[model samples]
Target: MNKPVILCVDDEVMILDCLKRQLKTEFRNTYVYELAENADEAMILIEELEKNKSEILVIISDWLMPGIKGDEFLIGVHQKFPDIIKILLTGQADEKAIRRANTQANMYCHLCKPWSATELIETIKSGLKTISKS
Candidate 1:
């Protein structure tokens, strides 16, 4: 069976790597980790993953990027796939962006750049609990 995916999008290579590392460390082989450097790539990756019958359970994205911003990207994703949990892990996002994400994208959580791994894992766990109950 194909494993459920956790996708992380960021413009910075290092940030993407770090997020992937942390997620892999925390979740172990529970999820298939995917990384993209921009919103466009992420959107395409999402489509491909879905086409391949892989379940994308979570998406963690950065706010500032080359093309689309995180809020806009997540909102688009939510419109198409409402069940995938969306999270913003950006230091650059302002209050307006965060509010927009919450209202439009149904974002599960927002964490700053220097995120605590424990908090991130806990947040994902809580979000997954709601999904499991439903």
Candidate 2:
């Protein structure tokens, strides 16, 4: 069986590397970590994973990207896969975008850029806790 996945999308290679390192430290071999450079790639990966009967437990997305903004991308993801937990990260957050993500995408949370590993892990844990309740 495939391990459930934690998907992360960001335009920056450094950020994607940091996220993989931080999440691997906490999750170890628990999840399959997939990274995409843009929303288009992420969407394709999502479809392929789903087609292969893999569970995508969460998605962490950067707010600013080349083609689609994080909020809009998450909204699209939610439309198709409402159960997947969505998280947004931004260096400079817009209230409207965050609010829209929260209301429209059912976002689990938004973290400011440069988040501590502990905080990021805790946020994902908290999001998973809600899934347990549901």
Q: All candidates' TM-scores?
A: 0.98, 0.97
Tell me the tens digit of each residue's lDDT in model 1 across 64-104.
Answer: 99989999999999999999999999999999999999999
**Model 1 scores what on Cα lDDT?**
0.95
Off by over 4 Å in 1: none
| lDDT tens digits by residue: candidate 2, 4-104 | 99999999999999999999999999999999999999999999999999999999999999999999999999999999999998886599999999999
Clash count, one per candidate: 0, 0
For model 2, what is the alpha-carbon lDDT of residue 61? 97
lDDT of 1 at 21: 90
TM-score of 1: 0.98
lDDT of each: 0.95, 0.95
Query: What TM-score should be assigned to candidate 2?
Result: 0.97
**Residue pairs in clash, model 2:** none
By summed lDDT, the worst window of 10 consecutive residues in model 2 runs over 88-97
Please list all clashing residue pairs in model 1, or write none if there are none.
Answer: none
